[model samples]
Target: MTFNIHQDYSEDTGIRHSKYSETSGEDFYHDKLNEIFYGCYTRNEVLELVLDGGDDGYTPSFLDESIGNLVYDFTLDVVKTMLHIVSDWEPYWIDEIEKKTYPKWEERRRKGEQATITKSHGAWYRLINGVPEKRVWIVYTEEQ
Candidate 1:
């Protein structure tokens, strides 16, 4: 089964930005750490479901064994510690265009000039704030 993980950020202006990632149930269970971070599932929820043999309809039955094994391999404290190591993550561009791109985009928007912005290339994972994150660069162009 495919699961969509979404992250949202809200600005002071009340505008919200959302980012999403799609992962298979197998991959999701394998990673485990992101279960809580991505808000897909919480460690407590997994533990309760597996231990109590209860179903909330969120976790797929096929992943039960994998989730059980993951719980068995590590204690809750250990999982918490591991999660702390990588507190959060964000998308980033591999080309590292933030410095140049943001200023130009802001200037264009400020001046009410016509412009086009695009992003391409595979997201490269990197470390930021002691967390592993995917990076995506921007391609900016002026409208003719």
Candidate 2:
């Protein structure tokens, strides 16, 4: 839905401000779309809203940025979920152990000694429903 920027903003002034007054056309929607994006929803729900070929909340200007962030977050969540599934119970213990044993394990491996790495067992779950732990992903590219 288009936001009515012309609505009365200040009672004392009775002045209606246009969103265009502050930012360019593109940026105005970017800000608005980002506002809706911060709400808690499953990755799938957000993706469906943005890309499932529907008019439901799909604003033209902010489409690219919102879609990009949504895709990145969804991919991260999927990977995290898969890792948790593969590890089964180990993810739980790994999440809890308040220690970084990676260095020691690497040292042992470098010394030609087989080191048993300990991983915690547990499922990966969101602390708050619908919010991802982090919004970061790595892209690996190969040179031809």
Candidate 3:
């Protein structure tokens, strides 16, 4: 049986993300997964999923024995895009990173910050600690 993964794309960050859901309420065999795809998020989580037999999230004995085959349609562009969006969506643990980053923008940052802003083609921008600095971060759902 072929596995179908779900895809989600966000324009603000210009990245796509994917998640796989069981269709028949039954665990899929490793060999049954024929076409796996990834959006712009990091591959580490996905890689772990592919090798779930030994990963903490999935039981090793069940995966190693019952799992069949696994394949992936990895897309660098999608990964890049997802990272772009995620970086803008969440910066850090601090309450207001942008306000703290740039003192000059403190006044403006205090006024509800925008989740993301577009700078140009292939370029996404976000503020941190009130500073006007550019940064990129990768996001994985498993991490959350």
TM-score of each: 0.20, 0.21, 0.16
Candidates' C-alpha lDDT: 0.28, 0.27, 0.23
Write model 2 residue lDDT over 1-144, tens digit each, in one string. Answer: 222222211111111122223332223323332333333233323311212222222223232222232223333343233222112323432332112233332343345442111221122222234454532122222320
- Itemize residue pairs with steric clashes in candidate 1: 92-134, 92-135, 92-136, 93-135, 93-136, 93-137
The model with the greater lDDT, 1 or 3, is 1
Between candidates 1 and 2, the one scoring higher on lDDT is 1
Candidate closest to the true structure, highest TM-score? 2
Runs of candidate 3 with Cα error greater than 4 angstroms are 1-26, 30-32, 37-57, 66-144
Error of 1 at 108 (Å): 60
- 4, model 1: CA deviation in Å? 9.9
Q: Tell me how many clashing residue pairs each candidate has.
A: 6, 11, 22
- Candidate 1 lDDT (Cα, whole model)? 0.28
| Better-scoring candidate (TM-score), 2 or 3 | 2
